[model samples]
Target chain A: MTAIQISVFLENKSGRLAEVTHALAKGGINIRALSLAETIDYGVLRLIVDKPKEAKTALAEAGFTVTETEVIAVAMPDRPGGLAGIVDLVTRHGLNIEYLYAFVGQRGENAVVIFRVDNAEEAITALQEGGAHVLSAAELSAI
Target chain B: MHETTPCWNREMEFMEEGHLRPLQSERLRDVVARVYERVPYYKEKLDAAGVSPEDIRGIEDIVRLPFTSKDDLRDTYPFGLFAVPMEQVVRVHASSGTTGRPTVVGYTRRDVQMWAEVMARTFAAGGTHIGDVVQNSYGYGLFTGGLGAHYGAELIGASVVPTSGGQTKRQVQILQDFGSTVLCCTPSYALVIGETGREMGVDFAGLPLRVGFFGAEPWSQSMRQEIEASLHVDALDIYGLSEMIGPGVSFECLEKGGLHINEDHFFPEVINPKTGDPVPDGELGELVFTSLTKEALPVLRYRSRDLTRIVTEPCGCGRSLRRMERVTGRTDEMLIVRGVNVFPSQVEEVLMRIEETTPNYLLVLDRKPRGMDEMEVQVEVSERTFSDEMSKLETLSERIGGEIEETLGLRVSVRLVEPRSLERSTGKAKRVMDRRDLGR
Candidate 1:
């Protein structure tokens, strides 16, 4: 089960991040979660928006370098050790997590976390075998 | 008292106008006759223009010869322009054309000898000696810059380091370890070398590197200052094209005022690009060259699209060869924005003078709804130039726009782009993007 994440290239100038958020807001698209990898001159803004396809199109129309990536979104308990239970399964299976970020305000009682692993299929299988509920693109977007 | 620079070929370089004119005339007459009889391309061009060998009796009558252009070179593909048999031709060089086939130039044995002498004179003018180590960084192979500079440095008795472009880190180490005295490469590569040296902690000012012969692309004077300051070497602008026998066609002497043409071998003229009439001396116009002594391929009044002014004033270096200002810009590269001429170099000169901006930039042209062609300069913002507020960045953009409009007298839009987004080309960098075709 893979969820799509929208990535936008943002120049490290003032009000650029705001412009991206403003464009998504204008398109009536909601951002679920975002992680900004910043450099000295520019930054890659990774967004897990509610509507990935429309977000990509809107941000691109706004003159941005946008790319859609598949990330594993797994549901887990909101407690601190509740996340370690899912992390231990992937670590025990030798799965490498490239990057991960947690966000609030999604559907269901459990919290949602986005995971970009080096090998997504193996990570999903290991997590599923460990009884972690993996969310699909539809289930995540519907939230 | 300090020692003065010496001429490589004293007899020819220091020849008085009284003796040099007739020599030039005699050679011009012979070459004109040779091309007329041998090369079918020149033959047809000359005959159509109602010109004959007798019409060109002296250097003053050079205008009688027909002008050959890149299109002419393309028409006569690979070996079409060779006046001599292929067996007699010693070497050939080619430059990639924007179209499919490349423009090829061939040189006979004697022609190769002439190239060596002129290139040697170029090095001599730069004060290169047998003791100095010359590191040649221009790319080797089909390109003429590498081999042209290689043969010239060898002819001048200097030890050669043939490190043809790329591996900039290795180049810096060679500069430090080999104790090279002279550096050769394009101005852009020189910047890369300086930056790479800083990264590697190589102190260029402490090294023995002295003079640099930079060419193969059009560069601004401010770039010279940047390279000189960074590499701690005196950078001299070398001018040439493959069609004109590569990088030795002309070179700036240590005097550094302008490049002196090897007039005895190659004749030069400044012409008004629009009317094709010879512009008076010291006036800006398109430059044209007519090879006086090339045997295998004798170019008769080859129209070099480079724009510059010629000065006949005496050079302090004691060479009688006429001087040309560093090429300002190419006539074809000139962009007409809403009826005004905009040069990419003018923008480069402006960017180089500014402290907050990097030289890597692109000029994009598009047509607005009212049919007005708009030009937007995409400038890469570095960390130091970047600000936390959007208004500050817009202010920087406005300042850039204001400065460019002040120089070109045309309003332009400035866009801030991410660093390293602009393409850094190994060869000639294409800076302008014309999207007007899509606009139309």
Candidate 2:
């Protein structure tokens, strides 16, 4: 029900993104899903990886300021209006989404979307009650 | 046991005004004639002004002589202004010049001794004594702060710990272990050391640090209070310029009233920056200095561009030397936004008063598309205050912007950056970034 997301504070300089990826590659860490939010001076690199503790230590050792956050993964119908339906349901339930990203599930029949909400537990309960499938941490990690 | 008076050289520091005036006149005449006879640059400038060495009869005629500016120094790059021959010149120092050619200064053996004497006076004014542990943290090499303080401490017979800026953690350790009685560096660097020391759980109040001499950059009174309270030391301000000499031109005595200028060796004048006329005493004006005893590189009425006023009123320290108020801003560094003048020091005062932010900030100036000047102050917040909550962040920004507007009388946009985002400098922090040219 709760997946750990690793976020990094990156200065918006040339080759910084490459440096992060290279550090992870050398550490044998694979990024499952990622999103980057940037401003003129700096950016935050949000990443979903297979190993949270290992990735955090490696990134920290590589001189990156890393933060571990809890996020919920929701499974949506692999159709035209899948994301739209989930968004409408969340909007109706009065849940706020800070940010989200989607990736195809291992089965290819459903799309798993990672949602970073203000309240992860409440968001998961509301989404489950709205008849959406929420993936557990172990299930997501296995995928 | 130290037997020297609180004033380094009792004879010179307490010299009566009558004696000082005649000494200045004699030294002024000798220096003017020396420059005119040896340096071709000064000879041409003096000839063009229709004045000669003989025309400079006394200190009163200093105004009649031509004024020298930094541009003139740049024009005569390496040795054009050295009055003494290369064989006679013993040492050389320079400004970083980050922008263009560095202004080079040469010193003969006597010139070096004169520098050391003024610095010694500065130390004594701050109540430094022989056998005291002096921690010199100002950067060394081409910059004068390091060597200037080093030589002065040695001349005063103080044990010199030439720590020379950086290694903040170690600086704190040494302050505790060495029992340093005096600290020397820029005020901002001192703050950095204080913050680092606190982070390392060093007990500054338990340390034996008695006095600190901070200079090489403009700082506000609020910053002084912060440094004094945090570092557990009496913070004193010292002023100088590489153009004339460094770190010993004037200093604050224990009275902490105003910096007593070493007028016997360097004559100071406050003048209207625009019209170049001497201002009445106690009126704010640009500072100008004429080196009366310098031999290697003598400046005649060199415009320091620092905005301050000279206080002829005698100080409580019993020294007859005239004191100049702490410089508020540089005439060249002042920014005009929407027809209102502002100095970075003013912004610094406002920012330091706010508890949520650190003193690290940058004033960015740009010309808007509507053809009006705009200013944006990018300030750094403490790690605890920086949050992902947009509302809270917005509120902090608005509060800072309002305070700046209330203090400086100008509306400015405030950007609260994360901790350590603004560039930090080991010496003379860069506080302003003029991006108006990018708009063009």
Report RMSD (Å) for each prediction in the order shown: 14.4, 8.7
The 10-residue segment with the lowest total lDDT in model 2 chain A: A36-45
Residue B374 miss distance in model 2 (angstroms) = 8.2
Candidate 1, TM-score of its B chain: 0.83
TM-scores, in order shown?
A: 0.67, 0.64
Summarize candidate 2's per-residue lDDT along B1-440 as a digit string, tens digits: 12333788888888888899989999999999899898899899999999988888888888898999999999999888998889999989999998899999989899889999999999988889887899999999999999988998899999999999899889888988899999999999999989999999988898888999999997767668889998998899999998888889999987888799999888999997877999999877789999988888999999998988998787777888899988867888777788776778678768878877888899999897778888999888654444433445567788999999998899999876656768874456788998786535
Which residue pairs show backbone clashes in model 1? none
Task: Specify the poorest-scoring 10-residue window by lDDT in model 1 chain A.
Answer: A100-109
What is the lDDT for B195 in model 2?
93
lDDT of 1 by residue, A1-143 (tens): 79989876577789999999999999999988889876555566889888888998898788676667788998898877878898898889888776788775444468888888779889999999999989999988877
- Output the number of the TM-score-best candidate: 1
Could you give candidate 2's per-residue lDDT for residues A27-77 as a string of tens digits? 999888888876565567888888888898888788676678788888898
- Tens-digit lDDT track of model 1 for B166-264: 998899999999999999999999999999999898888899999999998877777788899998888998988788798889889888899999899
Off by over 4 Å in 2: A1-143, B1-5, B336-440
